[model samples]
Target: MTATAFTSPSLSGTEALLLDLEAERCDAMKRADFARLREILHPSLTHVHAKGQIDDYESYFRSGGTHVDYRQIDRSELKVQVLGNTALMTGRQLLVAVRKDGSGTVRIDSRVMQVWTEHEGRWRQLAFQTTPLAMSVT
Candidate 1:
């Protein structure tokens, strides 16, 4: 395994674009911007939460992003790699969110991995999974 700094000059153009798209996705989630998410997320998207919950594209989008009320997302230590038409992104994020059912606000410090693929000239996220860090790294 190799660690590359986010600002490293060795990153490929595709890697940089994926990182930007991922950032936009995080921002869209926090702001409840479904239109932007629709553009970024693939039709067969799979999202796995740090708490073991799973959501597919329809399940997540049908809820209109009301499943969680996101207060903030702090992403760091991001790395992106591109292989042919696929891109992989990994990062650490500190998220503050509350369940829509009034379950109270919770803070999550996790490591995230995302898969993005280019389809018909557009890059869309296909999969996302997060693992809670044993100790807070953020």
Candidate 2:
């Protein structure tokens, strides 16, 4: 993986737009709005869960509401960078959710990475991955 610096001098207009879209995506996940998510995610999307499972676009959507149901997502230390028509984002996420198996609420802290590509005048998320922190949040 190529490492690029995420120095926040100031966010450009493009960066700000992408950042908002990312936030909106998080909201969609929390509410289990599958239609909204489908609009925002790319057809070739790939997501690597914090637990180490990888999901393609189809499987990712299937997991939601079946394995885990997101309730809230709080992002911090988020950084966004734009390269041509693609944007890269990285941040820490505190996600609160419940298992579909009715175990209980789970609070997870993780490092997240996402890639968005501009297509047909709209940005669609192409890739996402999360790495869990050593200790999960309560």
Candidate 3:
């Protein structure tokens, strides 16, 4: 998958950099590039799924290769706020993947919030949470 281009002129340098890293993270997940993911995610990372499951850095990385196969991860409407050494990012994410436990595929359309911080001279994702958008009544 091609990387999402960040062409908005209104974004600050930090915001642009953070969004670029976010895109890279999504690409890494789709490609199962755990090595690169390790560099971007913090040791204390907390990832909360839309289905209410939570995973830390280790479990999150481990699940990528063994428990779930990611097909696509798309993000849009991204906004980032920088506060001192920390950043808060919010966006919409569309994820499609399959479970290795014979449960077939899963797709999530949700609003995501992520926390990142400057650690050891590099920005690393510290936490992530998703809230599923309510389904429209037919």
Candidate 4:
């Protein structure tokens, strides 16, 4: 079977940088590396969870219970738009997570929207919101 092609074009350098930063953020999350998250997130960053909880950068790093082995992350349906120094990214993500237990695994599909800003020649995530996608009716 041939893989389908997906494309999302970025308009400016800031938008491009945000895409790279987001990739790094995913890698950091998979490794549970807080430092990487810190580097990519703005000091005033706000993260809205799937459950509608709001957390600041420090709070997010402090909250535990994030342990999971990520088998795969599929990011698609990306739409990036730039307005001045701010860029907005919306996409769908499919991630497979394996618990510490040797028993079973869980798959999560979500739609995410993230805002990024350029400050001092660097791009940082200013805000992020994610919502869980309903299961597919197959």
Best by lDDT: 3
| Per-model TM against the reference | 0.85, 0.85, 0.88, 0.76
**Number of backbone clashes in candidate 1:** 0
Over the stretch 69-111, how does candidate 2's per-residue lDDT look in tens digits? 8887888788887899998999988888888778777887889
Q: For model 3, how does the per-residue alpha-carbon lDDT over 1-138 read when each residue is reduced to its tens digit?
A: 223465388888888889989988988888778899999999999999776889998998666545777887878888899999999999888888777676788787889999999999999999999998842211
RMSD of each: 4.6, 5.3, 3.2, 4.5
How high is the lDDT of residue 6 in model 1?
Answer: 48
- Measured on C-alpha atoms, candidate 2 has an lDDT of 0.80
Evaluate model 1: give its lDDT. Answer: 0.80
The lDDT per prediction is 0.80, 0.80, 0.83, 0.72
Best by TM-score: 3
lDDT of 1 by residue, 10-90 (tens): 777787777778778878998899999989999899999776778899888866377788888878888777888988888
Q: In candidate 3, where is summed lDDT lowest over 10 consecutive residues? A: 1-10
| Model 2, residue 18: C-alpha shift (Å) | 0.9
What TM-score does structure 2 among the candidates reach?
Answer: 0.85
User: In candidate 4, residue 119 scores what lDDT?
Assistant: 65
